[model samples]
Target chain A: MLLTLGIIGILYVGILVLLALRARTDVKSSNSYLLGGSNLGAVIGFFTFAATLFSTFTLLGMPDFFRVHGIGAWIFLMISDAVMVFGLIWIGYELRKKARKTNYLGMSGFLELNYKSRFAGIVAFIGVFIFLLPYIAIQIRGVAIFLHATFPEALPMWAWAAAIVAVMIIYSEIGGLKAIMYSDVLQGILLLVAIWIVGYNCLHHFGGVTAMFEEVEKVNSALLSVPGPKGLFDFQFLLGSMIAIVLLPYTQPQVSTRIVILKDIKSLHKMAIGIGFFAILVILPTAFMGMYGAVLYPDASTSEFLNMTFISDQSNLIGAIVMIGLIAAAISTSDSQLFALGGELRSILKGDDEKMVFLARIGIAVFAISSLIFALLTSDELVLLARTSFAGTSLLAPMIFTGIFYKNAPNLTVIPMVTLVALIIFVASLLNFIPNHFLGIRMDLTLLAIMTLFALVCIYTDRSKRGGAIEN
Target chain B: MTNERIWTLCKIAVVILIILTFTPLVTPSGIHKPAFMGLPYTLWVGILEAFLLVGITWLATIVHSGRHEE
Candidate 1:
C-alpha cells in the first residue's frame, strides 16, 4: 500500500509542477486565461476534449453500471458516445465558427446575439448555473466516495473535496485554461493507461471475451436487456440518453474553447473523430470492467458497486491505481470546467460590466462549495442523476432545434413555448403528476414532440420576416 | 468565393451545426436532466459556441477587408 501510494504521490507532485510550469508562460488576461487566447492547437485540443469527457463518471460510475447490469451496460454507453460523435460534429464545428465571428465568449452571449434578446442571454445564464452546479456535485461525490470507501477513517469528504477544489482553484487562478489543458493532457494519458490495465485485468478475470459474454448470459437475463436493470429501455432512458449526450457537455464554455482551438475545419473533423475514438476506447474498457464486476460481485448496490465489487483488495497498489485514474478524471474535467465556469462568469455576471480575476476566482470557490453541498445533500447515485440531467436537456431540445428544421421563429411565440416546456418539465419532476410515458411514448419524447410543435409553429408563423429573428 | 459568399456560407454552416447538435436523430426519452456536473446543459453547450464564432468572425474579417480594399 505504501509503495503504490508513493508512486502515485511522486507522480502527482512531479507532473503537477511540470503542468504548472507550462501554464506559467503567456498567463495574462481573462481571454487567454479563459479561452487560451483562441490559440489552443491540435494536441492540446485533443487531450482537453478527452479530459473534459473523463469526469468522475468514467473512473467510478461506469464500473457501478457494469456491476449492476452486465456487458450490455457498457454497450449502451459506448453506443451513446458513438451516436454523440455525429452530434458533436454537427453542433460543435459550426458553433465554434459562429461564436468566433460574433465574439461570443459564452453560451449566453451566443443566444443574445442570435435571438437579439438579452432575455435569452439571461435565461441561458440561469440555465448554465443550474446545470453546472450539479455536474460539479457529482465530482465532489466521487471524491467523497473515494475517500470514504478507501480509508478506514478518511478525512471528511468535504475537507478532501475542499482541498481538491483548492488545488484546482490555485491553478485556474494562475494559468486559466493553460493550466487546465496541460494538466488535462497529463491526466488524459494517465486515464488511458489505467483504463487499459483495469480492462485487461477484468477481461483476464472473466477468462476472456467469449467466456465473459457467456457468463453474462448465465447471469440475470436483464443484463442483456437494452436498458439494463432500471428500465434503462423504458422510453425515458433511451430518449433521455440521446438528449443528454447532445445537451450536456456540448454547451460548456471549455468545450467552446476547443472549437476555437481548432486550427481549421479539417482539424475540427480530426479532433472529433480522434476524441470519439479515444473516448470509446477508454470508456469501452471501463464499462466492460463493470460487466466483469457484475460477473464477479453479482448483486451489489449501485453506489458501492465499483470499489466493493471491482477491487478485491484494498492494498495500496490497487487503491493507488484507481486513485490515479480517479484524480486524473476529476482534475482533467474540473480544470476545464473551472475555465469554462470563468467564461460564463464573464458572460452572465460581468459581460462588459466588470473584469476582475479575483472575482472570478472567488466565483470558482463558490462553485466548488456549492457542488460539495449538493453532492452531500442528494441521495441519488451517479446513474440516477445522469438520467435526471438528461431529461432536463431533452426538455430544451425543441427550442434550439427550430434553427435546424425551419428558418424562422417568432419571439412572441417562442418565448412562451420555451417557457411552457420548462414549466411542464419543472412541474413533471416536482409533482410526478403524470406517468413518464404517455400514449405508449416516453414523457420526455412527448415533451420533445411538444417542443418541436411549438418551435415549428413559431418558425412557420414568423418565417416571412426576412431575417426577422433568431432563426436561420 | 466572393467575400459576401464566404460570409453567407459561414453563417449557413454555423446555423446548421447548432441545430444539428441540439436536435437528435431519434426521439428522446422522457428523462429530464436537471443538471450535469452541477450546471445546466446550456452552460455546457457554451463550449461549442466558439465554433460558430470562429467561422462567422473569419467571414466578417474577410468582408471587412474587402470593404477596405474597395
Candidate 2:
C-alpha cells in the first residue's frame, strides 16, 4: 500500500515537473509567467484560488479539529473562510484595478511606489517570509505525515519531504505562476472529487452526522464547546483566530498575487465567489469526516482522528485517493507560498530582474529546509503547532490592513504596529498567560478578535488621514 | 466611497461582529450539532463564511457592469 502511494506521489510530481518546464519557457518574462499575462479569466482564477484556499490542512486537519473541539472549531474555521471571501471580494477587485492602472508588477513594487518608501516594500517582503514559513512548513509537514502513514517502509519521512519539495519546485521554477495555476487546476479537481467521496463514505460508515455526534458527546462534553480537550482555547484565542480568518487569505503570497494578476474586475469577483463556494464545500466535509470518525474511533486524539480512523480506516485504494487529495493540497499550499516567497524575496532588493528571480528560487529552498528541521525537531502537539504557527503570522494582519485601507498611514508606523501586535499574541498564546477560555470561548477565538480590532484602528486612522489630506 | 464600498465595510463589520457574538458561544458542542436550516453548522460554516458569497456577488456585479473606470 505504502509503495503504491509512494509511486503515486512520484507520478504526480513528475507530471507537475513537465507542466512547469513548459511554463518555464516564458520565465524570462517573469510577469507573463508569474501572472499568466494578467489575462486569467474566471475559470483559471477560480481554480487557482480554490487550490490556494482549500489547502491540505483543511483536508487532513479540520476533521481532526472537529474530533477534539467538537463543532466549535467550525465557528472559528467557518468564520475565517467566510471573511477571507469577504476580503477578496473588495480588496481583490481594487487591487486588480490598481495594478492595471499603476503598472504595479508586484505587491512590493506597489508599496514602494504608493508609500514612496522602500522600507514599506522591505517590510512587506520580510513580513511574508517570517509569517509564511510556518504556514508552508505545515503544508510540507502534513504531506510528510501523510506519506509516512501510507508508506512508512518505502522511504524516510525526510526523503518523502524531499520528493514532494522537488516536484513542487520543479514546476514552481519552470512555469512560475502559470505552471502552478495549471497544476492547481488539475489538483483542484482531484481534491474536490476525493473530498466528497471520503466525506460521504465516512458519514455513511458512521451512520450519519447526527448519530456520530451522540457518540462524540459521550467522549467529552467539552468537545461541544470552545475549549474542547486540550484546554488551549479562550477569549484571546477566539479573537486571535477571528483575525487570523480575515488575515489568513492574504498571508499566502499566491493569494496576494491574485489581486495583481487577475485580468479584470468582473473575472476577479467571479473568481472570488467561485473559490468561496468551493472552499466552504471542501472544508465543511472534513469536519463531518471528523464526526464520522467520532463513531468509529470515539477515543482518538484529534490528530489520530484525522490521520488514523478518518483517513486510514478505508481500503488501500480509497486511502490512496485521500493521499492524492492531500498531495494536491500540499502542492497547492507549497507552490503558491513558494511563488509568493519568490516575489517577497525579490522585493527586498530592487535591481536586476533575473537576479531577483534567482534569489527567489533560493528563498523557496531556505524556507523548505527550515520547515523540515522544525518538523523533525518540534515535539509540539500537531494541532497546537498549527495554531501557534498561525500566531506567528498574526503580525502581518495589522500591516496589510493598514496598507490596503490606510492611505496616509505613517510610513514609520506600519512595521512596528504589525510586529508588536503579532508578537504580543504569539507570546501570550505560548505562555498561556491569556485566558485559555474566554466568555465560554477558546483562546483561538480571543486571539482573532484582538487582531481584528488592531487592524481596524490602524486602517481607520490611515483612512482618516486620506480624508484630512484631501480636505486640506 | 460608493455604497458598494460602504456595503463592503458593513459586511466586514458584520462578519467581525458575528465572530464576537460567537465569542460567548465558543464552548464545545458535539461535533455533529445541527445549525439553522438543519445543516450541521460545522459542515455549513461556509454558508455564513463571512459574506464571502455576498461580497463576491457584489464584486462580480461591479465588474460585469463595466461601471469601473481604469
Candidate 3:
C-alpha cells in the first residue's frame, strides 16, 4: 500500500509540475496568466468547472452528509447542482455579456466598474474573502484529517494541511489558471474513477441496491427518508441550500470567472449541460457509499467512516488511488479558489497591468497562507461549513446580479451599501451574537429575501425618479 | 414556437420543478416506499428529477437565444 501510494503520488506531482511548466510557457501577458486568454473550449471548461465545484466536499463531505442526513442530501446537493447548471446557461449569458463590455479581470472590479463606486468593489471583495477562507480551509482540513487517519503514526494534521497548501501555492504561482485547469482535468477523472470503484464495491456488498436499502432499513429506516433522524433537511434548509447553490456561479468569483472565460455562448451552454450530468454521475455514488455507511459504520466519525470505507475496507491498490484522488480533489478546488480571490484583488487595483498582476500573485500567496491557518482551526463538519460558505457568498448575489442586469447600476450605490449591512448581520448570526433564525426563518433566507426586495425597489424607484424628471 | 418563447418555457419548467422538489411529491417526509428498480422512494424520485433537470438544460441549450452569440 505504501509503495503504491508513493508511486501514484509521485506520478501525480510529476504531471502537475509538467502542466505548470507548459502553462508557464504560454503566459505571455497578465491576461493570459490570469484568465487563460479568455478562450476556453467546452470540454475543458466542463471538466475545470466540475473539478472546482465538486471537490473534497463531494468526495469526503457528501457521503457523510448522506449518511447523517439521509436521502434528502440528494435533494440538498444534486438537485441544487442540477438547477445551478441550468442557471449557468441562463443568467450566465447575461453576466458574460455585461462583463465583456469591460476589461474584465475579477468580480470585485466588475462590480466597481458597474456601480461607479470603489466601495461597492470593496464590499464584494470583503464578502468573498470573509467566506471563502473557511471554505478553502475545509478542503485542506478534509483531506488532511483523512490522511492523518490513514497514517496515524505519520505527520500531524496541521503538517499535512501545510504540505497540501504549500504544494498548491507553488504550482498555482508557477503556472496560473491554465495550470489549475489542466490539473483539474486529471483530478476530475481520478475523482470519478475512485468514487465509482468504491460505490460499486459498496453496492456489491449487499448483492444489489434492494438488499442495500434493506440492510439500511434494518439498521435505521430513517436513513432512507427525508430529514433522516436529525431532522436537518427541513424545507427551509433545503430551500436556502438550493437558492445559495443556484446563485453560486454569480456569487462565487471562482465560478463566475469560468463563465466569462468560456470561448463562446455555445461552449458555455454545452458546459452547463455537461455539468448537470456530471453532478448526477458524481453525487449518485456518494449516496451508495453513504447508504453503505449507514448500514455498517453508522456512528463513526467523519474521518473514521471515510477512512474505513474509502481505505480500510478496500484493496491496497484501490485505497492508494482513492487517497491520491482525495488529495487531488482538495488541491484542484482549493487552488482555483485561492487564485480567484487573487483575481478579485487585481480587478479592484489600479496600476500598470504588470504591477497589478504581480501584486495579485502576492495576494494569492497571502490568501493561501490564511486558508492554511484556518484549516488547522476549523471544525470537521465539512458539508455544513461548506454550506455556510455558500450561504455567506450568496448574500453577494443581489448586489452582483443588480450590477449585471440593471442598466443604471452605477446610480444605485444603495444596493452595495445595504449588501454590506446584510453581510455584517449574517456574520453576527454565525458568531451567535444573534440567533441564526429571524422570526422562524433562517437568517440567510431572511436576509437574502430582504436584499432581493430592496434591490428591486431601488431599481424601480430609480426608474420612477428618472421618469418624473423626464416628464417635468 | 420561437426559440425565445421556448427559452421562456424552459425557465418556467425549471421553476416549477424546483418548487415541486420542496413539496411532498418529491420528498415526502418519512415515506420511503414505492421503490423502483429496488431503489427507495425519494432517492429514485430525486434521481429522476435530476435527470429531468439535465434533460431540460440540454434542451434549453439547443433553443437558447444566445447560442449563436460569440
RMSD per model, one decimal: 9.0, 4.6, 2.0
* Candidate 1 per-residue C-alpha lDDT over A246-338 given as tens digits, one digit per residue, 9 for 90 to 100: 565444555666776665655565566666567656866765577676676676655456666434433457667767777767767876765
Q: How far in Å is the alpha carbon of B65 misplaced in model 2? A: 7.9
True contacts kept of each: 0.00, 0.27, 0.88
Docking class of 1: incorrect
lDDT of 2 by residue, A23-98 (tens): 6664355466456666777898888878876676777777766766565666666666665666676555555555
Lowest-lDDT window of 10 residues in candidate 1 chain A?
A401-410
> Which model scores highest in lDDT?
3
- For model 2 chain A, give the 10-residue run with minimal summed lDDT: A463-472
Off by over 4 Å in 3: A26-28, A468-472
Instruction: For each candidate in the order shown, give its overall lDDT on alpha carbons.
Output: 0.60, 0.64, 0.92
